[model samples]
Target chain A: MDEAVSATAGARVPRTERGRRTLRLILDAAAAEFGERGFHEAGISRITQRAGVALGTFYTYFDSKEAVFTALVRDMSMQVRDHVAPRLSGTADAIAAEGAGLEAFIGFARAHKEIYRIIDEAEFVDQASFRTHYQSTVDRIVTRLRRGAARGEVREDIGEVHGWAIVGMNVFLGLRYGVWNEDGAPEEIAGTVNAMLRDGLKP
Target chain B: MDEAVSATAGARVPRTERGRRTLRLILDAAAAEFGERGFHEAGISRITQRAGVALGTFYTYFDSKEAVFTALVRDMSMQVRDHVAPRLSGTADAIAAEGAGLEAFIGFARAHKEIYRIIDEAEFVDQASFRTHYQSTVDRIVTRLRRGAARGEVREDIGEVHGWAIVGMNVFLGLRYGVWNEDGAPEEIAGTVNAMLRDGLKP
Candidate 1:
C-alpha cells in the first residue's frame, strides 16, 4: 500500500508500521464484507469483526462505512496498478507489456474475485470512485500507449479511444476468464488478445 | 418485443394487440421507473403512474418489482439487439458490420442512457438476468463472427474470447462516448475502433 491511498480521506493516516498493518487488515476485511454483503447490507461492526480488531480500531482507521468503502475502492484500484506495473517493466516491448499486464490482471482477478463485485458496486455506492477507477485506468493506458508510440512500437494515432477499447477488452476478459470461470488459460487468453493487438483481426 | 421475452416469467403474456400495447406501456414505464429510482426504491404504483395506467394494469403484466426489472433487462437487451442487427446486415463485410453495430449501439445508448444503470444494477438485484444479458450478447457476437469466418471476412480463429473482447470494447465505448459524455462523435469513435479492429495497434 502507498501513502496516498493509505492516507485516504475520512480515515486517519497510519503513522507506524503496525498501524499500517492494522489498516491493511481493516481494508481486507472490508473487501470480504462488502464483497459478500454489498454496500447496503455490509456493516462496520462486521468489518471490524472480520478484521479481528476491536470496533474502536476500525474507527481509528476509518470514520464510517462509506469512508472505508471509498478507501477500499482506491486501495483495490492501486493494488491492480501496483500489480501490473512491475510486470510491464520487465516485458520485451509495449505490446508484450500489454500482454504481461493482461495476464497479471487476470491472475490478480482470479485471486481476488471480490474485486469486480466491490469495484462494480462503487457505481451505485460511490459514483466518484467508480468513475475515477475507470478514468484513471484508461488514462494510464493512454500514457503507456503514448510512450509506446514514442518508441515506434504503437501507432502514432493511438489515443483515448484505443485506451478505452483496450481497457474494456481486458476488463471483460478478466470477468469471463477470471471471476466467472477459469475456462481459458490466462497465457492463452492474453496471447490471443495480444495477437489481435499486434495484428488486425483480418485473416 | 419478441414472443420469448414478451412472455417473461412472472409476467402475464398479452394475447391481443391492445393487450400487447398495454404491456409495452408498462415495460416502458418500468424502464423509466427503475431507471430513475432504481429497483429497490422504485414502486409499482409509480410505474403505473408513469404509464398512465391503473395499478391493476401494471400487475396485469408484471407480478412484482423484480419481475418488471427482469423484464426491463430483457427488453433493453432486445432493444440494443434490434437496433444494431439491422445496421449489421447492410454492411459490406463482418468487420464493417461490427463497425456499424458499434455505431448503432452507441447511438442507442445515448438515447437510452438509463439502460446502463438498469443493466448494471441487475448484477446485484438479479444475477441471472445480468449474466444472461452479457452471455446472450456475447453469444450473438460469436455466432456473427463464426458466420464472418465462414465467409472469409473474419479470421477463422475468432471465438468466445474475441467475442467477449469486442462486446467489452463496444460496451465501454458506449459508456464513455455514449453515456458519460457526447464529446466524441459516435461515427468517429466507431470508425476509430473499427480501424483498430481492421488493423491492430502495431505501428
Candidate 2:
C-alpha cells in the first residue's frame, strides 16, 4: 500500500497521538451533526464547535464539508467492522460466528443509532462512498462464507446470494431490534436469526 | 372510510375515471423524473411535462414537489405489494409462498431498479414515509409468519425477528440480483434463498 497516497486520500495523516485524537473528535462530532440535521442542513462550524476544535483547525484535516462527510462514512464503516470482529472469536462454527457478529452489530447499532442515517444519506450525499461502503461490506461477507465453505462448516455454494441475504438480515434486524423498538434484547434477536440461519423455517 | 379525510391525507382524490387516469399518468411521470434527478433536484414542471399534462393540472392532484414525492413512494410500495401478492396464489405452503414472493419481487425490482434509490432517499427527504414503507412491509411479514405458525407450517415462535429477517433477506437479494447485477436468473436466486430458508446453511 502507498502510505502517502492513503494519507492524502482522506484527512491529513496526524503525526502525533494528540493529532489522532483530534481527528477522531472531528469525526464523532461530524456524525452527530450529520445525524441530527442531515447533510445539507448540518454546518461545519457547528461540527467544529462540537469537536472542540478551533475554526481554522477544521480545515487542517478536511478540505471541505463533503470531504469530511465522506471520511466519516468510511470511519463509521470501519468502526462497525472493528466492533463486530472481536465477538466472533469463541464461536463453535462459522455460522455461530455470524450470529455473534449479528449480535454485536445490534448492540453497536443501539449505541450508535445515527449510523443508519449517515450511511443512508451517503447514497444521496456521496455516491461513490455510498457504493464503496456496501461493496466492501458484502465483500467481507463473501470472504467469510468462502472460508466457511473450505472448512465444510457451511454449504459449499454459499456465495453472493447468501452473503447479501445475511447482510440484509443483520441490517433490518438491527433497525428493528437495535433502533426502532429495542423490544427484544440483542442476544434474543440474534439468537432468533441464528436459529433461522442454521435451520431453515421447515416445521 | 372517511372520503374527505382520506382525500386530504394524500393528493386530491380524482373524481371521474378520466381524472383517475390523469392522476396515474402524473404519478408514473413523477416516478421517472424523481428516479432520474432525485428528490431535491427534480422539479414540478419537469414532472408535469413528462406526464404530458399542463402545469395547472399538476396542482389539481399534488400540492407541491414534496407532496408528489410522498405519493410516489406510497404508490411504489403498493405497486410492489400488488406485484408480489398474486404470485403466492398456488404455493404448496406459506414457505413456498414466500419463495414465490421473492421470485416475483426480484423480477419487479429488476424492471424498476429506481425503487431502491427512491425508497432509500425517503429516509433523508421524508422520514415518516420511509419508516412507514418498511414498517408496513414488516407488518405483512409478521402476519404471514403468524399465519404460518397457526398452520404449523413454520416455527410457532416466529415473530417480529423472523419477519424482519426474511424481509431483509428478500431486499438484499433483490438489490444484488435485481439492481446491481443481473448475473443470476430470478428463479435461480429465489431458489437459492428458498433452499436456505427451508434447510439453512447446514451441509
Candidate 3:
C-alpha cells in the first residue's frame, strides 16, 4: 500500500480521533437520512447538518451523496456476509442444517432490518450500481449453495433452479415483509419458507 | 354505476375519439419513458413531446407525473389480471390446466416486461400504493392455493407455507430476472418453478 497515498487520503482530515469520529458521524447520518427520506430526497446538506459537520468536510470524506450511499451498502453487505460466514461453515448436513441456517439468516435480517431496507430500496435508486452490489451477494449465495451440493447436502436435480428459487424467495420475503413491513416476525417467514423448501411447494 | 363516471373511469380520458387516442399516446409514451429512465428522471415535458401533445393538453388528463404513473400501473394491472383470469378458472384436478395458468402468468410478464419493471421499480415512487397493488394479487394466489388444499390436491403438511413460498418465488423471479436482468424467458422460469413445486424440492 502506498503510505503517501493513504496519508494524503487522510491529510484532508485532522488526523486525530475527532476526525475518525466525524467520519463515523457522517456515515451514520447518511444511512439514517437515506433510509428515512430515500436517496433522491436525502440531500447532502441534510446529511451534513445531521452529522454536525461542515458540508465541505463531508465532501472531503465522501465525494458525493452517491458515494456515501455506496459505502453504506458495502458496509452493510459485509456485515451480513460476516454474520453468515461462520454458521455456514460447519454444518453437519445441508438439508438438516438448512433450518438453523435459515433461522440464523432471519435473525440477522431482524437485527439489521433497516440496513436491509436501505439496500433493497436502493435498487430503485441507481439500478445499475445497485444491481451490481446485489449481484455480488447473490453470486456468493449461489456459491454457498453449490458448496453445499458438493458436500452432499443440496439436491442436484435443480441446483441452479433451486439456487435462483431460494435466492428469489429470500429477496422477496426480505423486501416485502422483512425490512419495513414488520406485520410479522422474520423467523415466522423464514420457517414458512424452510418448510416449503424441505417438503416441496405443493400448495 | 353512473354512466359518466363509468365512461370517464374506463379510459380516464375524454369521451371524444381524438381525446381517447391522445390519452393512449400519452400513456404509452409515459410507460416507455418510465421504463427507460425510471419515474423520477422521466419528465412531463419529454412525455408530452413523445406523445405529440401540447404541454397544456398533457395536464388536461394527468394532474402530475405521479398521476400519470398511477394510471399506467392501473391499466397494466388490469391487463395482467384480465390475461390471467381465464386460465385460473379450472378445478384443482386440472393440474395440467393449473400449469397452464403458470404459463399464462409468465406470458403476461414476458409481453409486458416494461410494465413489470414499472411495478417492481415503483417503490421509489410510491411504495405504499405499490405494496397494496401487489398484496392483493398475492392474496388471490393464496386463495387459489387454499382452494387446492381444500380439494385434497395439495399436501397436508403446510398449505399456506407453500402458498407464500410459491408466490414469493414467482414474484422475485419475475422482478429480478424477468423484468430487469432478463437472463431467460419467463416461460422457462415459470416452468422451472412449476416443476420444482410438482415433484418437491428434494433430491
**TM-scores, chain B, all models:** 0.94, 0.93, 0.75
Residue-wise C-alpha lDDT for candidate 2, range B28-117, written one tens digit per residue? 998899888889889999999999999999999978988888888888888899899999888887777888999999999999999988
User: What's candidate 2's DockQ score?
Assistant: 0.65
Q: What would the per-residue lDDT of candidate 3 be over residues B1-203, giving only the tens digit for each residue?
A: 36344323324568698888888888888888897888878999999999888999988888888888877776666667678778767634434444566667666776677875687666667666567566766676667655565666655454434555566666656566655665776667666777657655322
Docking class of 2: medium
List TM-scores for all candidates, in order.
Answer: 0.95, 0.93, 0.80
True contacts kept of each: 0.68, 0.84, 0.43
Regions more than 4 Å wrong, model 3? A1-23, A86-92, A96-98, A105-113, A201-203, B1-22, B86-107, B156-164, B180-182, B200-203
Docking class of 3: acceptable
Q: Candidate 1 lDDT, tens digit per residue, A58-105?
A: 888877899999999988998999999999997777888888999999
The worst-scoring run of ten residues by lDDT in candidate 2 chain A lies at A1-10
lDDT of 2 by residue, A129-188 (tens): 877777778888778867877887777777777788888999889887888777878998
Answer with 2 or 3, whichever has the higher lDDT. Answer: 2
Root-mean-square deviation of Cα positions for candidate 2 versus the true structure, in angstroms: 2.9
Highest DockQ scorer: 2
Error of 3 at A53 (Å): 3.8
